[model samples]
Target chain A: MSNPARAESIAQLERLVAALLAKGVVSEAELAAQQASTDRASPETGARMVARAWLDPEWRAMMLKNGTAAAEAMGVSMAGAPPLGVLEDTAKRHHVIVCTLCSCYPRAVLGYPPHWYKSFSYRSRVVREPRAVMAEWGSPVADDVELRVVDSTADYRWMVLPLRPAGTEGWTEDQLAALVTRDVLVGVALPKLPA
Target chain B: MNPRFSPGSRVLVKNDWPEERGPCHIRTPHYLRGRAGEVERVLGAFRNPEDLAFARPAETRVLYHVMFDQPGIFPADGKQPDKLLVEIFEHWLEAA
Candidate 1:
């Protein structure tokens, strides 16, 4: 941890955070709160909603229509965060979410985004060659299914409600929830039954 | 303020960047400029991030989630018919 390279990165991060604070872009308390909130919304929370939507048709409708309200109803406090949009995947359509500018994501429900999700390559490449990028991620879309790439360019963060895998009938919420991975929520991969 | 465009309105993103705003900071992506798309959702008026970046009082502008065709954006690379949705401010758009 005391290596020169590591020290340089640490210093860079410190400078960036300090600059943001000084510029009134974000406050210390707000940054701390966001960090704490990210800890609370793990993949489990995402799974919980996805599982609930899978079980209850009404909840699924609500989730697709307005994800911010759905997250609030599920007791996830997303105060000061932008509105959430849950893109439901169906037989005909698949959805993927990315932030071409800065990586704006549904951190309250899906936690922090992966490092790759914030990469410049991902931001530029995905928009141009979605199918190729998706295929590389191991989530190849079928020829018949239409792909929808959503860019988090403004004040709304987005997540994906992937299609429920087959053969999980009569499964408990916790069991089904476990299958809903963060990758699925980000649309980089899909949930699968146990092999 | 009443929004100029509603959901499903066909609009083209303004390609010009007003010189008065200067060139330091802008939220609208370069790839989306001049692209024709339909307003998928109307996000209410909010402080413009471009102005906010400079620590100035941001003038509120209506935002929209505009949906564009993949081919229209990346014609050569667009193998599959897909949709690309980007949020754009009302000022950066005009009825197509």
Candidate 2:
């Protein structure tokens, strides 16, 4: 499916990488490693964490209270990877996360943020316009809750575990896990009852 | 991109500077975008992530990865776009 346009995209990526290399902003080795990290355990670990948090209230509480500790508790260590952080959003105040300096995300806890998540529009606008962004994700205001935006930085990165949605009250942890969306885990959307 | 730049060039952002804005979608490290380096090399023919990310066919007009010194582009609040990769159109630059 790679036509001239697609070829152009690939070429652009090549030139961009070349530019980066000429500048030594990132080493060829590091860039190659990052480009190859797409298939590692980060996404698996991240998804598993969200799933587990849904099943265990204690673990969920731990994650909300302290992300690194909770991930470690779940056996998801960030030893060789970037640090991990968790931000929680509640009814009184909603939390939206962004890294305005770089895509410094908790790859150990959540996989690469969707390109849109780490965009100028998202980063630049979230803090100034949380309600608008959240609404787009279908996580609207409760009509009484305040909005709060959290900026994750280079030294630290964040992922949010949104408050559990209603509807399968007696459901097991596994059941709840099935309901959590990456957006929900990131507090961008709510996990409502299946439609 | 030049390794250095005249003072009148774009502001040079330090790598260690922290962003003050809340979570941003697009972030360029301050050091790259804010730092006013010379027009080191016009790496011709590439798509800016701003356009590429959005799949904007129109904005994909040849990207020139500009170079910067200690500081390039910096917002008053000290915010940085992703990688300091300013998706500037080539016309934005004026040779010094």
Candidate 3:
């Protein structure tokens, strides 16, 4: 309350809201008029990014080469995307992510990580044995697929750019986004598309 | 169950554990997180902001400063890309 910067932040918000009495900022009615918008990162964009890569080998190469730039080429803005580093899941190995210290995630690209990703159960064990974790999630992969682990720390945050699963011969990107759950991005679920 | 790491040891949190192996997690920031820091001149409770903010003087306990390589944590690959230090109970310590 005394710190100048923090005080300013709160003051500015108070001004924007006009006032805060017993109730807090109520945008329900106002938000409805303005057209409901997503608070979490847009999955539609992520699905498209994946779809484009799947359709174009060149783009796939670019994605592997430089994940951030590759994301931009697909029209997925990285503005405010966490210091995003992507882990590629190869046929021989799968990948999963956990933020043991805290819930540091690519909020801009993939949106908020599910609460479980931050829970001690996941943070503590995801690294100990990823295969078991994925199995619990219902999208277990072959033991052959190597399991790559990632830790999100102060400087970096990570997301899994899973290899495009076989199937969906002609599905649209919008449809694909529906299947791209946060769990998949975190490497818990390997996009269980209809193969 | 295998422990990711043991108490009181200086270790680097795997930046890309998913790309490699071992314990990993995004270090959240406080006064401390991921920095190559020291356990500080050991003694009694560490002073935390919450302790100061909430005025929980009675409940406050001694904590190590637990320095990190970098003074602070950021989003980039190397914003203060030094090392990390975190303070915890005695059991959290392992050989650095």
Model 2 misplacement above 4 A:
A1-38, A42-44, B1-96
Task: Give the per-residue lDDT of model 2 (tens digit) for B1-96.
Answer: 332333234433333332354432233443343234433223333334444555556343332333332112334322222112232334334444
Would you estimate the TM-scores of all the predictions?
0.88, 0.53, 0.53
Model 3: residues >4 Å from true position, as ranges? Answer: A1-40, A74-81, A170-175, B1-96
TM-score of 2: 0.53
**TM-score of chain B taken alone, every candidate:** 0.88, 0.36, 0.32
Kindly list the per-residue Cα lDDT of model 3 for residues A142-186, writing each as its tens digit. Answer: 745555555553334556667766776687766666677777777
Docking class of 3: incorrect
Best by DockQ: 1
Candidate 1 residue spans exceeding 4 A from truth = A1-32, B18-21
| TM-score, model 3 to reference | 0.53
Model 1, B1-96: lDDT tens per residue? 789999889999988766557666666788888889999988778789878888888899998889999877899887656989888999999999
> Which of the numbered candidates is closest to the native, going by highest lDDT?
1
Q: Write the per-residue lDDT of candidate 2 for residues A113-137, one digit (tens) a residue.
A: 7777777887776654556677787
Docking class of 1: medium
